[model samples]
Target chain A: MSLISQEVPAFDTRVPAYLQRLERAMDALLPPAGTDPDRLHQAMRYACDGGKHLRALMVYATGETLGVAPECLDPAACAVELIHAYSLVHDDLPGMDNDDLRRGRPTVHKAFDIATAILVGDALQTLAFEALANAGAIDAEQKVRMIRSLAHASGSLGMVGGQAVDMASENLTLNIGQLESLHARKTGALILVTCQLAGIAARAPEQVRHALDRYGRCIGLAFQIQDDVLDQIADTATLGKTAGKDQVQNKSTFPSLLGLEQAQHRANALFDEARDAARSISGDAEPLLWLADHIQQRDH
Target chain B: MSLISQEVPAFDTRVPAYLQRLERAMDALLPPAGTDPDRLHQAMRYACDGGKHLRALMVYATGETLGVAPECLDPAACAVELIHAYSLVHDDLPGMDNDDLRRGRPTVHKAFDIATAILVGDALQTLAFEALANAGAIDAEQKVRMIRSLAHASGSLGMVGGQAVDMASENLTLNIGQLESLHARKTGALILVTCQLAGIAARAPEQVRHALDRYGRCIGLAFQIQDDVLDQIADTATLGKTAGKDQVQNKSTFPSLLGLEQAQHRANALFDEARDAARSISGDAEPLLWLADHIQQRDH
Candidate 1:
């Protein structure tokens, strides 16, 4: 059940380069720290400055798999990352998860004031849609579809809705089905939309869209299960966030409902299903396959 | 300087009908109150339920002025109202304005919980964009434009930025120009976008769009100035929100900077400019003109 007991996949040589590109793009997209309302602009940049860039990677990977160029994927990539960052900023607020740290840095509310943190999150969420709308490489129709997809994924019925349920369900026992449903919205929705955005960017046919969506769903669930597992076995320094908080808060996690061994097995099965979905598309899928392995095997 | 001293424009029979239509559209667009995650959904509906709905009215009036059908304007109307609602929700939070009452009802945070209120604001903002994207009458291009406009208006450089400045400037004196700049972002941005959305919906010519933008700018500023004037003079029962909160918080306002009499004069001047801008368009501008008069004359 230990994370070290699981086999580690070899590092993909391309990930670092992709992450570097994404970081630069995001920096360019965000307002400079010196801008008027400097505190907010600074917080916005700080909240998004560092992360694993996994969501951006998913966007790029899916786009590459569908033969869409990386340049065309940058907006979707940056947009998804912004959404992820905003969620973290909100989730770490004093009224929410109340975490002091995120990605090894002081959370936005700690660094700035609570009001600034809330505004930072709000501004970042707005910037996500703005980034997509102005993604010039994508056509109007594609922009609309991407906006709809991202908004739907991030809204009440999607990521926010999931968080609501998660908050409400604290200290209450839930079956595996309920847990899966919660994670599907809380985390899976945004991840799923990253893939869906790539499909929109590529102007993929209906069949390819279906395949990509299926792949996204599987990987999304697998990723969360891995997160729950990591929270159990990983330390704060390794995870770069507060680990074991779920248990401390009496929240029912994957490891709480299913034993660590079964959760690990379930994550592995989802990873396999994700890879199969990617492979079903009749084209190069190296990036997606590597991502599947990376999600399952990453230690932190 | 008294609000009652201003001449009330002839009652526009269309205003009530438009409000009725907007209410119906918003109800249909929002998730049912009984849906799963019932509290958040219920909060979202509550946040948006009743107000003067001035922003939605602006959208309808502008669309009507441009000869766009009312049905085509419903999505834009709903979108603006949702954004307005979301801003109010966040503005009323304990860390923000700390208002306990809004539109004669307990604020979302007081009615529900702080976390739920935060999520409700976020979800409503997301729903605004989603609604615009799914607006059946508009073409994809228009939807993209509307999304971009709304996002830009609602984001840092627009409403949120305005809020940050407003918060930071507490207990500080701001000159007239600085006060205008603050209100321009905080309250003016969304109002401006309502007109722009209508322009896009009508497929208005470039000249008409420019004229509408100018008209929107004048009216947006006028509306905020009136709000400030009202806060100083109107009672809480009539305002349906806390009166004199700005003064209590030491936040700068039009009346604070310009004096009540001068602020009223400025609002009237802006109303006149707005009517002129609307009249400059080569069409019957009755609705827009009526809206301009209504904004300055409204007691609350």
Candidate 2:
């Protein structure tokens, strides 16, 4: 579930087509009289394309596991994808991570300018809600609820909060506990929202939704923990950005705070927790069980 | 109203207190533990305080004239004020407006840093939805609907689209129609959302809501037209920021396109349209009429 995991099924066959459709959807939303869409669209496409789209797959898989219709999950899946896309755009802004490259190419701001990157991020954020609001297959209240769930997950209390904490910790010392708390609000919140949204879209029972939420929380941490592990073990060829740059920034991580062996054990434990939570809920999620193993065991 | 109009009112006694409460609501929603409450609080207050607070007045006065109780309107008024505050924070970000000063103080990003400013803006945006969602005495569906309205009015098709246009229009020549289209979307959209949110809170009839929306669209343009007009007539002492920066940037503006005299006349016509729409919809709109006059005849 972290960057470019080798075992995550190769980008879905339909994903390219879906990406195409997403572009068409985005283009249609822009007014004809506005500044040329050529550049904005190009930048949006560059940033939005090439993800493994685990979020979308989770959504579609959730519906399938629950015996719900694929159509029932299409909008939910697309809405989540939009959120993921928006998060990446904002994450790569000049002020945040300041990454010049992502997924083996220039980041949006690097390829375009800072102002265009900002608009790209803003447009994507708005488009996420726009997709949910106009998702014709769902109940209006359900769509509204979906928008609320996504907003909370991506907003200050969630990912942005995490970013804030990360910013606070930079050039400072922190223990493992504090670092974990930072990641929980930042990364865990949205992953939990992901699972909860899927469950809600499937109309799963409250108990089941809670269990899936726990599962996502565990996996989110496990994913980041493994990311720390890979930051030490992996090289730039496999990991997109320069490896060990996190260390250069004096950022605290599981590996730095708790040693690599201990971080590995913690990740394994989190995977176990995810498996247990998913298994205990309704629906046999053998694929999720496989995913938990895959996450802890991935090479890159 | 333009900065040079002759009918400016002294500061309303309670508007300051209302702004304070809005500031507190925004501050309370930041990260609970990692965030420095004092810094975040100071920034929120600095970012939101000292505005004209015309949006809240519109909400409060609109509800009042419609015969709705103050209690029913407070949350809606708070919500509009929150949106205005959020927009200012984002608009002043390095990639958007790159503004370092707002309301005679350092902008949020300048007061803190760009990342905090972005997060603060994101947080405020979510809090607007949270405010509407948790607003007491409002029906659940309508609460959700009002949240959607704010998003719609501010999102891609509205404010975001306007911003994209604004950013894209740097150094480009434009006619009056194009200038109006941009401002109508950027500033006017949110103004319309403010009035609609009030109508929704008051649970006004659909016909009245629609009529108020029309009124808002008209007055929203007038609001910006006057802003453009004032940029020409007012000096820095009265206008705060560089008085004629719009012309300096070659940014398309009403006065730039229509000339100062025509821009002033267009503003009056737009205000007239707003007044007629409000009155035709209901004779009980005495407060809205007064507010409209206040908008049309303001000084500084």
Candidate 3:
């Protein structure tokens, strides 16, 4: 399943450009870090600042491959990133994972008081919806659809539900199917919606949208498996988070169920499927292809 | 400012009907209590139940007055109530107010674990936007506008901002203006947006919408002042929550700064203004007038 034998393209030259654009858009959407309620606002900006911007890159890459303009995708990009950031902020609270670091910095509750951390998460979630609601260049119907998809993906049956199940599953054994379902909701739902947002923004036909969704599904699971693998092999310094904590927490991970080697093989299989789905779509999918490869090969 | 001189109409017969409709609509929107992730879903329902339904009632009353169908207003009503419920859940967290009782029942964090409470709040907040986004009978444009208003009112610059300020202001002296500003955001923003949702649903003219906004603003402040006044005068049994906690927590209140009598007078003044605004709107105005009177006269 290795892609090294095939002719590979250079890294997407557009990645840095997309990252810059997303940052600018996010800054515009966020409240000024200096304003009153200064502490909460500053924390909000801080939580958002350092990240891989992976979800946002999905939005931009998917939309651009479908020939949608980059500017039109900014709000959707910001929405997913904000949702991701807020989830981390809440997850790292004392009642949850109680992690001290994220993105190589102190967690929100560690840097600020717990109350401010809760508010920051709450406010960031609100801002995600606001960004989509106010996003220009898209029609009202599409915006509504995007908002609906994003909300559903983030709600109890999706990301939050997954988190709840994950929490409840701690110290309990889960079969492979159950673990996949949980990860599908906890991380995969948001990842899947990133592509959905882009498809909605592009006004893509049903078939193209389905293809993009398939692509998203594959990469989403692949990315998560890779994460689990990294937790086993990567150091805390490289991961920018406490590594191997999953084993310590006794949580069921892909590697735990399938063994590390089988787990990585599974991720490779998903990445290959993702590449095929990307190729099935009309227009340039080189970026999607590049993203799939990058996700599979990333060490941290 | 007293309205004792005017002859009052009987209580609005539609109030109970609106409440019934809102409850049914909310039930339909929420996941079944017995579903998987049972604990989180159950806690969400638990937090939502037993509220006074004042915000949803505001939506129903105002929309009905402006001639929007009750069915059209149901989603908006559910949305505001969801937002209010989520706020209460998070506000009761140990890191925040650490309240043990709400509406005479154990707080979500007390009945459920803090992790469940946090997820419940997060899920409910997502559900609020989902309700608005999926609202039937409204055109795409109006739905977008409602979503925008709700998100803005809920985000950093609105309810969350007010909460941050309130938390920071504990044990510190705040001037009358500062206290009012804080309460306006903490409580008033959501209340004001309730009427705005109704107006948007009704597609009311700008003039009438403006009048409803005036009525909402007046009643919102009046409502908060009455709450402060009740905290000073009422006991825990009557308030269904911990009374006198504000003073105990060293939080400033209207009666604390203005003295009890003056604070009550100020609430009455706001009530009178709300009545005038309600009268100006071209509609039955009876429901709104009744709501204003009800809010002003409620003991809890």
Error of 2 at B146 (Å): 2.3
* TM-score of B-chain for each predicted structure, in order: 0.95, 0.87, 0.96
Q: Answer with 2 or 3, whichever has the higher DockQ.
A: 3
The superposed Cα distance between candidate 1 and the true structure at residue B56, in angstroms, equals 1.0
What is candidate 2's CAPRI-style docking category based on DockQ?
acceptable
lDDT of 3 by residue, A16-75 (tens): 999999989988998899988899999999999788889999998898888899999999
Q: In terms of DockQ, which candidate is strongest?
A: 3
- Candidate 2 residue-wise lDDT, B130-238, digit = tens: 5665566666666766766877787656776677778889899988788878888889998888788778777788899889988899889999988888878888668
**Which lDDT tens digits does candidate 1 get at residues B60-164?**
888887889898999999999998999999999998999999999999999999999999999999999889999998899888889889998999999999999
Minimal lDDT window, size 10, model 3 chain A:
A2-11
A28-131: candidate 2 lDDT, tens digit per residue: 54434334444665666566766556666566554555656656666667667766777777777878878877666777888888876776776666666666
**Stretches of candidate 3 above 4 Å error?**
A1-11, B1-11
Clashing pairs in 3: none
Docking class of 1: medium
Query: How much is the lDDT of residue A116 in candidate 2?
Result: 69
State the weakest 10-residue window (summed lDDT) of model 2 chain A. Answer: A5-14
